[model samples]
Target: MLNSKLLHKKLFLDSGLKTQVKEVNTSNLEWTKNFGDIAPFMQLDLRLIWRNKRTKSSVWMLALGLLYGLFFYPNPTYNNMPFFFIFIGIFSTGIFLINFGQFVPAWDSGYYKLLMSQNIKYEQYLKSKFTLMALSVVILFVLGIPYVYFGWKILLAHFAAAIYNIGINTHVILWGGSFNRKKIDLSQKAAFNYQGTGAVQWLIGIPLLVLPMIIFALFNWLLSFEIACLVLTVMGVVGIVFHQKLMRFITGKYLESKYKMIDAFNQDN
Candidate 1:
């Protein structure tokens, strides 16, 4: 009887071990599958950022944007000026989104047609850009946290601006890129390189940078500084809430301009 009991226990232990190994194998497989799905897109973005001198310049610009507060925060003359703070907040937080996003698939101008020929969906392509821009806002905002040493108000302003950038400005720039899309020569020097600059880049700045300030200014003028910040943050939250819808709309814009952009980019080659 004791021998029989020991045999039964051994069988149960073996079965449990097999189940555990199978579960671990399944988990690892899922992880590998997910990484496989995203690896190409991740590699594409990294290559665009590091291989292109002009696109890489945006990293330096991001560093500059982060230190921008050191110039204004230390000056007493700029103190108590909430509107100026709002401007700095938006510029510092969204600088990358503005610089990088305005170009969009234009950065891929060299191989854009080939890229389009791939099995990748247009919505996926645009969403990747959106994700990159949104990630920049979050990262910039986190890095900007040290500015709280200057004043809590400055931090609040930056928080609102970061939210606004992530939610509204990201979509705005992506949509803008769908219009007047231009080709960028990755071979161009990063210094003073405006290879892809067009009217769209200039015009889009109004909504991305200026419009937020105007909205904040009105609220600041009408009520108080805190109220202005609250209003701006609310606007951003609303934008984030409808992110999927906004992405769908922007993807459609890119689809509509697909042929036109192809023609324009071809002209550059």
Candidate 2:
């Protein structure tokens, strides 16, 4: 019976609702009934990411980061690379934040709802998020970093930033989405403080870009270079360790609470 059901699902997916039914009557193997059915939906989530222009903003943002690095990188001829790494490494945070922010709402409205409602585990969803995030960061750095930091710092800084980014801000937005309890209709100006969604995106971007620098710069001032880097390294570790706590907080608390609120608004349409 399981095979019978699953085969029906795959037939429906590969062909169409009407055609699959026509074939299912004759076929005993059911491919569609299993939880494995969600695999295609998961792949679709990533493929559909590009259709979203806001998410792709990371590409242009990286271009700008590279341009900024071109100007800001320490003069190699003068042997000032360490200062350059400190500055540019901090600057890269902005790029990562901007990239992460682009996906917050899309996750809220699109994939989060789908995954949470499905039988799929949040663990799988996290894997997808990290995978996509990794690809996005790699693409961004490949485009931005070679021009800025040389051999070792580039690699070290990339991993360091990825750690904090995946740990903190990515988790925050997910946390905020649930904790915020607001459906956030981009069409409605009032939902986002009368400024519009563009304003909200900008607001999110500013902090993503600035927060780490503030952390690093303040620490850098009080301590030596090695200590400051060590602190950020700790944040990177925190990102990996506590990600599940952050996701659960978002899903169970904030997101579940807003179900009725969003339902009421969406029902009218």
Candidate 3:
């Protein structure tokens, strides 16, 4: 029996099983080292977004956002209103935030299990997504410079809306992502595609866009347009100041729902 056990051990070593195990452990260690870094994961997410056809559609949306002033500029009805410019800024800069954000981890549903099984940090993953959306806001704002032709106020409204988006709506959408369970296929074209969408996504727009608009409109009616803008700006600044705390809460939500998300993603539908 002792000789038989020795022979089995010899066979295991001779079959290279021990070596293979060591190699796999070494590879896992190296992978953890690389992907564990925020920069690398962020770069990887960006590369995936750029390569995916659905995400690339945001380019057209960005272009349309840049020219949004064209529609309002010619329309005397909306051109003069501060609210119009603010809405434009929110919708324009928020293209990616709305388009890509609603899906959250659902976007990676295909490989989410593999990702979760790895030694990856949830905060790092969520951070990369937040960074991507934040970058989109900046790019959209820059592309919207031509709206200055409408008026400097339009530009100011855009700036204000961009800040509100970065500070407030960005987190809101990410928080909303905690509820996403439907899987999205990146290969699908963006036009009319609503694979991962649900009631949460639809309702999210209310708080992100409508609530602020209502506040601004009420304040504008009660006080002045400038004050309305100031109110929105102050709200955005407050959101920015408390961003870390918000992220912690949002991260906790994600953690709490992580298993549910995994189970949901594993479903056929």
- lDDT against the true structure, per candidate, is 0.85, 0.51, 0.80
Q: Candidate 3 lDDT, tens digit per residue, 106-195?
A: 878888888889968888788778877888899988988877876778888888888888889889999999998887788988889877
Each prediction's TM-score versus the true structure = 0.85, 0.59, 0.83
lDDT, candidate 1, 1-269, per-residue tens: 99999987777777889999997765442332254445456557756887778889877889988899999999998887888888899989988888788888788888887888886888777777777788888999899999999899999999999999988899889889898667889878889777888899999999988899999999999999999999989989999999999989988988898888888899854
The candidate that wins on lDDT is: 1
Candidate 2 regions with alpha-carbon error over 4 angstroms? 1-42, 52-55, 59-62, 74-87, 90-97, 100-103, 107-127, 142-159, 179-207, 264-269
Model 3: worst 10 consecutive residues (lDDT sum): 26-35
Ranking by TM-score: 1, 3, 2
lDDT of 2 by residue, 1-269 (tens): 99999987777454567777786665433332243543454464444444444444444566665556556445465233443454465456446444544444443453345444666554455444544554455565566545434556544555556556656666654544333322333333222142213334545544455676567667767985556666776886787687767566655654455555344334322
Who wins the TM-score comparison? 1
lDDT of 2 at 16: 64
